[model samples]
Target: MNLEAIRAIYKFEMNRTFRTPLQSIIAPVISTSLYFVVFGAAIGSRITEIEGVSYGAFIVPGLIMMMILTQSVSNGSFGIYFPKFTGTIYELLSAPVSYFEVVLGYVGAAATKSMILGILVLLTAGFFVPLRIEHPVFMALFLVLTALTFSLVGFIIGILAKGMEQLQTVPLLVIMPLTFLGGTFYSINVLPEIWQTISLANPVLYLVSGFRWSFYGISDVDVSVSLVMIGIFLAACIGVVGWIFRTGYRLKS
Candidate 1:
């Protein structure tokens, strides 16, 4: 079903990433390394352990999650937004490409790029602190699902955005704050009981919690709950995308 169209779109997007490795890849990797240096090395020196794992190691999953979520969404949003910004989208709309195939190409590329960054960050973590995966399979599962989910979220952002400034609004204003407060640097259990209850309301907590559980086998929320939350979010995003296509929301115009 228009497999070649999908490949062309996928290849073009991927090539764009390669062409701007500095902005697309190296910058995030370096920023994350600084996070390790400041948070993991500087702060971790004072706090030795959290839930039996070294503070440095404990933050690894959270950092990875942060990088992937931001990157996935950024890439997904930019991938689509650029086409719209440059008016290339009208060309694609007139092409014999189905909406599903277009989504697959863009979202798939975004997720793939996010995974690449995530894996690199994971490898980079090995040098700062000892790393272990209690459940490698689940770790991979969480990594893949999170990348795909957030990439789709970014895709939606791209579709909704009417200008360049609008593209950064959600990720910087909403997502970045959610991630920092979502147990990226500390476990929610250590917070006051009241705060812990409030933390449960933040969706990013489940993502960080379950991913951490895959690494250390301890979590603030039930692992199954995290999985279910991700599933729900992913399904919701897919539903929104389908509706967008059906109604030609922000696309036809």
Candidate 2:
């Protein structure tokens, strides 16, 4: 609500992120490089082209989504968690800043980190395989929306979390499993009819499918459906997080 306060918190979080370049920057780059080597090169070689694209190239969108999802989640979660751990959160709660400002600050920085890593991984993928951008605008839109959605989810986890362990729980326990099962490396079309139907239940599958569509002008799933799912997820995250802040779910005793 307060634009100045939101901007101030946003700038503060961005500066804090820069101070620790390793967590915000280096780690994602390293992890993405390893993924490009192992999954994109090693395993990709064993499999031939899928949907008329090389296996390495085909997985690029998935890898980018994976990096963006993890970075946004981790950054936003920790951004709130550390402030609470250090007692700065009490100051924030007492400040004139609204809950929207707090989330916008932390979530914006987290999304920026995800975008940076997404671009980096895209570049890295190019080194291994020829890269193409079939729909640049849609690709950018999906990336931003996915980043914002996960950032909000991370903010909720951060607010609800009581300790550092809880901060790691969501991504490790939930996001990871969902991503692997989301048709990241392989399309659901290759699976049995039942498994294919099950894969459709996964939200991450829609994200991966939509992103792949941007790259190759083709996808196993409908792009509009993916966009709609992401929209719903984003709305749900924002609504729940807003409720948590208003009710002081975990922030106030």
Which is the leading candidate under TM-score? 1
How many clashes show up per model? 0, 0
Whole-model lDDT per candidate? 0.94, 0.88
Q: Residue 35's C-alpha lDDT in candidate 1?
A: 88
Deviation from truth (RMSD, Å), model 2: 1.3
User: Per-residue lDDT for 175 in model 2?
Assistant: 90
Cα lDDT of candidate 1 equals: 0.94
Q: Compute the lDDT of residue 205 as modeled in candidate 1.
A: 95
lDDT of 2 by residue, 94-168 (tens): 999878788888899889878888898898788888779999999999999999999888888888888889899
Question: In model 1, which residue pairs have backbone atoms overlapping below 3 Å?
Answer: none
